[model samples]
Each structure stands twice: as C-alpha cells, then as structure tokens.
Target: MAARKKWYSQGLRFSCTGCGYCCSGRPGYVYVNDEEIAQISQYLGLETAEFLSRFTRETHRERSLNERPNGDCVFLDPISRSCRIYPLRPRQCRTFPFWNSNLRRPRDWEDVCRTCPGCGKGPVFSYETIEELRRVIDL
Candidate 1:
C-alpha cells in the first residue's frame, strides 16, 4: 500500500528574509474578514467603521485593504518592506505559503519563488507551525 501524503509533503519551505519584495510595488488584493478587520482596527486605535471607511475598499461585497497609488499596500512601508501594522496585519499576510488556495499548487508557487530570495531555502518550521498558520487564517 502507498503511504499517505501530508498536506505539505512536497518539501516546500520559506522564511521571510525581510526582502519586502512581496510587500513592494503592486501587492495583489488582500481579503479581510470581519474578525481581521476588527482586530486590525482595534490595533490601530480606531473604530471598525472608521477604519473600514478610511483604509479599505469594497469589491463585490468583499472588503479589501486600500493600496497605495502605486498599488502597494497602504500599510506597507516602502523603505522597509515591513508592515506598519505588523502587529495587526491580517491573517493573510501572516500565513504566507500556507494560506488560502494559492499555495496548494506547486507550479503556482514557482513564479513567486523565483523572485523571493527566501523562497526555496530557509529555516524549517514544524508541521505544528504550519497547522497553526492555517488555523489563524481560517484556511
């Protein structure tokens, strides 16, 4: 009989080297759920309504954080590629290669992996960590 395959058994790995490449330039759309919105708004010392109005845009009934004119995320500090609201960043940012349906495809990761220095090699996190990330993002 064949051994069962784990979710991430493909041996994919990554560690944020702080390159900020992911946060730079035009960051793609980042979805924000109600809980994430509340957490981030509270972290910024604002009411949810105010934060939503000032920092977010509505699209087809979903909410997304506003991006800069250049398309980078508003919370992304261009110079540092670091999140201004790191403590309150949405679960999407925290999960990276483990979030949503994107990373499920190995081929899809290649384009991103090619540009990120930390893609193919980095510190190995335990399976527990990956599972935790999944939980945080509600994946």
Candidate 2:
C-alpha cells in the first residue's frame, strides 16, 4: 500500500502576480515532454525541429527548456515579466506551488514561499483543487 499524503489543514492560497520570480533567479529544469514541446512550438509558430534546437537542451536524455546563463528562463519576457508562451507552457510551469513536493510539509511550502511572493497570497484553494494541480491534470 502507498503512504497517505500529508495535507495542509489551512488549505492554500496563491495567485501569480506576473512578477517573473518563478522564471528568474535559478537554474532549474523546466522538464518538457514531446506533447508539451509540440504544443509550445505551435503556439510560437515554430516548426518542432526548430523549437527543439532553439529553446531546449537535452537533459539526461529528456528535453527541458533551457535557461539563460543569468538564470532567467528563455521565455521569460524581460519587460513584462510574463511567460512568452503562457497558454502552452509545460505542465511543470503550470503546477507552481501546488506540486506534491511543495505541499508535503508546512515548512516546505514556506521555504518555497520565500522566493515566490505569489505562493501564500491571493485566492484560497480547497484541498481538492490543490490535489488536482498536484496530480498534473487540467489546471
């Protein structure tokens, strides 16, 4: 049997402020599967091959969106602080603070919140809502 999940009794609240903090200040993998890459490529009006060559790097044999040397995600708009291809962004980008890792412990959530002003603010989400995001289903 699987271990039960630890849930936040207080529920959770968050809203993206378009601050770009999530897209900036860290070199981390934005892991993307083929379906996501195709979606993003179509959104950007690029051929899949061109998109793969320009926007991603091979990460342990899987593809992940590359970040600039300064740590900003390649699609993070310098002026607007918005994702360039918001609608077709990878599932990893859509999940945000609702990921299973972030929801596992109170301190884990707080730890992530330090870098993300959006993590603990704005509209509250019920347990079910958060669970949906964590499951990587429709957002």
Q: Among these predicted structures, which one has the highest TM-score?
A: 2
User: Which runs of model 1 end up more than 4 angstroms from their true locations?
Assistant: 1-7, 126-139
Candidate-wise lDDT, in order: 0.76, 0.85
- Which candidate tops lDDT? 2
Candidate 1 positional error at 84, Å:
0.7
**How does candidate 2 score on lDDT?**
0.85
Quantify how close model 1 is to the true structure by its C-alpha RMSD in Å. Answer: 2.8
TM-score, structure 2 vs. true: 0.89
- Backbone clashes for every candidate come to 0, 0
Q: Pick out the ten consecutive residues of candidate 1 with the lowest summed lDDT.
A: 99-108
**Cα RMSD, model 2:** 2.9
**Candidate 2 structure quality by residue, lDDT tens digits, 1-79:** 9866566755798999889987889688888998998889998899999999999999875788989999999999888
TM-score of candidate 1 on Cα atoms, chains taken together: 0.79
